[model samples]
Target: MANVDQDSNLDGATEGSSNANAPLKRNSDDPGWNCGTLCDPLNKDAIKCKLCGFICKAGITRLKYHVSGLKGNGVAICKNASKEDKAVCVALLENPKEDKIAKRKREEEMRAEVEIEVEDNEFYAGSKKKRRSNLRPLDKFTNPINPEGPFLNMRQQNLLDALSKERTHSVHQFCARWMYESGVPFHSIDNDAFEKFVEAVGQYGRGYCPPSQYLLREPLLKEEVERTKGLLKKQEEESACNGCSVMIDGWTDRKRRSIMNFCVNSKEGTTFHSSIECSTDSHTGQFIFDYVDKCIEDVGAQNVIQVVTDNAANNLAAAKLLIEKRPNMFWTSCAAYTIDLMLEAIGKEGKFKEWIAKAKNLTIFIYAHHWTLALMRKFTKCKDIVRPGVTRFATTFLTLQSLMEKQEKLKTYVY
Candidate 1:
């Protein structure tokens, strides 16, 4: 940046130029042009010095730059120009008042040039004229190119029809199909195309647009769960119910480690132990009880009704703490498991053991063997009630009942 000091004169003179011997003068016709010796007296409406061409535009206010003695691109020679040309050109470039006027004049000139080109092109579209026109009129009446009919191209229309047919399926599947088969050589999608696709997908993009999970997926989902839990906690706080209930169960996997499942019933949604936390170490009675306490504190348990669990001693022990904390808190053993236990106890007394063993074997054989159902159909006239696919929980008594009634041929296996 260049600095213009008030004490400096335009004729490469500085501090010494402000002497009495120096006087500034201006011509009546010129506005900013001046000739002068510095510190000269000036008439009203007089800005230039006739002697030195120094500008006194701002009344001694100077523009200070970071660098001293640095000059920008040099100004043009205007002394030889006619007064009118000088005035018009200099005013066009420098006057703040002429900005809008100059801009309008340039725009008018550009519009005229575009009109002439379009006329010439119409007269000679295929006669040595280029296929494309660069300068087209902006207004609707004069514009030569416009989309008059169908909005989508052939490929886009086909994709739209396919997606409409499979409206029940996910939008991602639709997009994936079109993106793979569009066959248009890979090129940048225009703004209109991209926006159209976004509009087509609509709200389906919320969960369907795959998130880049990487390592943070679990952490992010956990945060979401906690946020949902907070809303449930708010509901619990508002309710006046005297007690809440919890249920606990555990199972050992092929890895032989006990995994627990806990459910806390509240006015809010049922809170199930997610698979991620099921394998955590909370199997013992004390541990499970402590875990429940922590969960209560997490949700601010003040109005719990009762806790319920299977006939596990650990569950009973944990129920003790809840009774102590809230005297009204009650515990109930699961009746379904209790009945199964009673049946198991009675089965040990007589020939019922043989029947139980045979039932277990027959159920397992039909479930674990794939060809047993077909074999059973061949031997007897009795129709098999088992469904014609893999049974997800075929070993359960409910599913095994269908298999046991079929009289399926048994296939033995040695493990």
Candidate 2:
């Protein structure tokens, strides 16, 4: 029954195709025919073209293009009227000369009014001398702390020293524990400042000294965090060549809270490694815009080229605002994100799911036997994921390439 219905639909489509080739018949709706009161002077019998004997079509755009004067004839008539024909041999009668002049005046007035309306709203109101809270100059940052001694004392230092000696321990992990033991706030302190201090004193080719004793004194961390932020803001302003792109993404904290994280990135240079602009607050479109604005103000906007991100609406909106502000700024969508979106769309559409399920079942089938697992690994080369531009992913091509290579193996694990 379904096959019969499909065949019937196909037959109807074929009939429509045959009818499409039939020659067009002239009617009142034809383009070349003057349906209005104005008539072509040469037309009398069926209002036909006298030269080519072709009937005038309805809904002609303008008769002026069809009107032309011959050497002796008052006006030659259109014999070869067609949609594409350039030469018009027929003169369609026009309205009185005064009516044409009045229409021209009305069109001019309408155009003038539109221009005035555009000019009225183009300028926005703002204070020229205003200090935008977002754009704090470097001199505005005020140091709020006076230092004295090692942040931690001898006993806490001993524990940190012991933790540092352990192969698997990181100083950040050790510092967090030390902060907990010393009764000083570690999580509340500025992480970047603490991180720098720890690196400089404990691990920078200088043998492990209980440097937290000197560095982690009395919750100077908050001040350090502020100071570090201020320095970063200053460096971005001072060095216009910092060639970094900022990425912003949002997520919920463990407490089911919303947060935005801003990260700055760039390729490593001859003298310095690439830098990251980690924002102090949650990521938001406004935050991202302000960050880009500040970065542009610091380094000239022209120096920064492209911002790459996943196709999140907020990120897309931010890119638009950035482009409006800095017209030359280019935006590239993240390659991995683009490919994932394409594949996800395909999965939702029900094409890829069966294949994906098959891959999953293959994992179950192979893993049940140890020999099958070895054979599977030996027979299969890594899966090839599509690159960013392959569908929509253009930015971060390498990242997507790597992901695609492991796609078959990862698909089993990814769901």
Candidate 3:
């Protein structure tokens, strides 16, 4: 502590203290600081305002303004002080000491709060600092903690810390699988509302940490494998020696990847057999024949009765090749494909094309605006227009039929 004599000088106050933890010497020039009364001088760094006999904490710089006749800093103006100091103080009532120390302290606290908010956001979005917590297996965490402890037996935070990398990764996989299967956008995790939800869980229900998409893929895949195996086992047990029919179809998905899907029907059940991505291979008769042959062999050719495929020329040729190899089973074209093709041929006639064109225009316009669609649904008691099916032939007739059914509602909505 620097000794302060009656003379007003701050030369000694600035010396002998380069350490940050050292008590700050009062700057005499500060609007709130000055000498105390002679009887109890220094006042252990308290501000002794003789005018109002007010004494406050040492660094309450605001008090200096009050003693100087200022009315800010949550203090009233003192009745005493020279007329000159009073004049200067009155103009500064709205603005008290803009002290660097107090400003810096407030700034630091604000920054800390901002940092906590950032961390919370990152956690909910399944993005976090790479720092490892010494978390143990959740098997241990399942046990209740000692109620007598200050907090829960194992602090939720300790549990968070205890999580091993593997367990954390599994949790991440769980979250990812949930979103992917539900068709949620991958970036939804980064939304502010999502962050608030995770933060709420942490604050109220116990801390929750979300997992990432990549983390979820592995576990969900394993689960899918097990689930498929279970289904296959059940089907095998239920199936009798009765003949089974296999149906196969080839198409490109929205992603433009070629896929071949197979299904089997029997006394057991109609079950999806498998799907193969054949993007790289040509969809020729030979390719289709080989796959059909493999399917028959795998399901036991002795129990196979027939095979079905769409009426594509390639599919028809492939079926012929398949039957030649295994004369035990017959190949058939799908009735649904035949119906769709017949409808398409009818729609292609010039007389029908006029009506189809008009229907297509109306559907295109109605679907373009969500509000218009909603209005149409309301008038029709909330039934949406039939969505276009995969095949143009089917889609056209289906939509036309729907338009015909809702003709009155469509007229009402149009006007």
Best by lDDT: 3
TM-score comparison, 1 vs 2, better candidate: 1
| Collision pairs in model 3 | 32-64, 134-162, 135-161, 135-162, 135-163, 136-162, 145-153, 172-211, 173-215, 173-216
lDDT, candidate 2, 1-415, per-residue tens = 9999999899877865764543222324444443222234334323333335444343233332333322343334443545333332232323334678886676445433432122212222222332222212231122111112232211112223342344223334655676788898756564444434443442222112342544566455667777766757644553356566655445555776665454555553211212344445646677667765775555455556676678887777888888887787777787777777766666555665565555446456766877766654553442323233433323233434444555544544433
The true-structure Cα RMSD of candidate 2 reads 30.1
lDDT of 1 by residue, 61-117 (tens): 111100111135232242433555444444534464477788667654533343222
> What TM-score does candidate 3 reach?
0.46
Candidate 3 lDDT by residue in tens digits, 99-132: 6567657644543343233322233234454433
| RMSD per model, one decimal | 39.9, 30.1, 30.6
Error of 1 at 327 (Å): 2.6
- Worst lDDT run of 10 residues, candidate 1, spans 60-69
What TM-score does each of the candidates earn? 0.40, 0.31, 0.46
Alpha-carbon local distance difference test for all models: 0.48, 0.47, 0.65
Off by over 4 Å in 1: 1-243, 267-269, 273-284, 346-354, 363-374, 377-396, 403-415
Candidate 2, which ten residues in sequence have the lowest lDDT sum?
139-148
